[model samples]
Target: MAEVVEISDPGDPRLADYRDLRDVELRKHLEAEHGLFLAEGAKVVRRAVEAGHDARSFLMAPRWLDGLADVLERSDGPCFVLSEEMIEQVTGFHVHRGALASLRRQQLPPVDDVLAGARSVLVLEDIVDHTNVGAIFRSGAALGFDAVLLAPRCADPLYRRSIKVGMGAVFSTPWTRLPDWYDALPELSRRGFTTVALTLSEDSVPIEEAVAGVGRLALVLGSEGHGLSPRWEASADRRAIIPMAAGIDSLNVAAATAVACYAAARR
Candidate 1:
């Protein structure tokens, strides 16, 4: 079982990592310098445990410990037991789920390794919203996509709000952030994967036609409001659009992802 330590003082150095409820700088610093990601709520903490993330510490209400006893038993780290009021004070918000963990981030395998045996993959470009990212993961997992890739501006999948929004699917899905979007498409084609960009351009073929011919495929989804930029049209092997009602121009990015994922899986 993980050792449960009682903490009351907000200024205690032992709780340095968990202190300051609204310290965005601190969170980013921890991620950039320490390579730790925050996993919040019972659901995400459970997922992180199941995914084998190296847990460093837990901050939670004393009563919440019982709910995580099994997870705690497997966690080889300190669990800080605080009162509900103390937790609120520590986090600067009401964390209704009552448990949060700090986990060491694991290194992802090379993109080739991720795509080696995969038939379908989703590539996201500059998806800045955490909610959208989470929704996409839920849809991707349910629709049977093999893995997900994020472009540089995509929100961190391990962010607390994203974990909650994704219902822990972020941990279940295989994901890695690709630094260079320009090289990704060509590299994927060289690996025997056709690249399909999701857009509503005039030249775009119906999604069914694009899905019909591809074997190993990378389905690219762009930012929610802007859609795919002009440069991607020439780079991708095919452009696809989901047909909608007479008046409806397009679905939300997350909704489009669900539809695209379903189409890709059937291919």
Candidate 2:
């Protein structure tokens, strides 16, 4: 069972894990150094704990304790009870969901392990937005894709904003970073998955046609400003584009993932 400790100081060292969340680079380094990730909101925290992530600690106001009592009771870690203002001071945001947990990150399964028995998957290449990464995971999970593969430089799906935006789908979805960016699409092809690159290439076919009749498929999407890298685009087995109105060039990456995943689910 967890012990509840009341803290009045924002400078408390015990609260170190939850500090300065808005500082992206600093948080990344700190989280990496500590092997931890923060899950915000009551539901996301519950999901993270339920998904077998061990909690390092929990921070929340007194009012949130009852709502998360069952979870806290199961944890051996400390629960830091603080005033709302103190929490705001430590975390640098208004935690509307009223609970935040710093949980241990486990080793990600290998690419092959995530791909085993997966018929449909989404491949992301250097997508930098946490929201897009989370949204893509949610779409892929909801629309019947079996897994997700991220390029080495893609945003961390376990980032707090991503986790909140994804509604904890990142915890449920099977995913891992590709070990080799240059041969990622080729490697998928070697595993018998038809690699479909979502881009605006001249030879691109409609998304439906690109995925039609394929038993094993890997749908690849790229970063926000620039699309897929030349190596990835050129190496893909098929190029696909989601048709839009005459004037519009493309949809946002998250929107594109939803549309493509919906089409792939039907295929």
- TM-scores for the candidates: 0.92, 0.98
Candidate 1 lDDT score relative to the true structure: 0.82
Off by over 4 Å in 2: none
Instruction: Give one digit per residue, the lDDT tens place, for model 1 in 75-133.
Output: 88899988888878777888888898888888876776666678888888878778888
Model 1 worst lDDT run, 10 consecutive residues: 13-22
Please write out the lDDT profile of model 2 over residues 61-112, one tens digit for every residue: 9999999999999998899999999999999988998799999999999998
- Candidate 1 scores a C-alpha RMSD against the true structure in Å of 1.9
TM-score, candidate number 2? 0.98
Clashing pairs in 1: none
Q: Report the Cα RMSD per candidate.
A: 1.9, 0.9
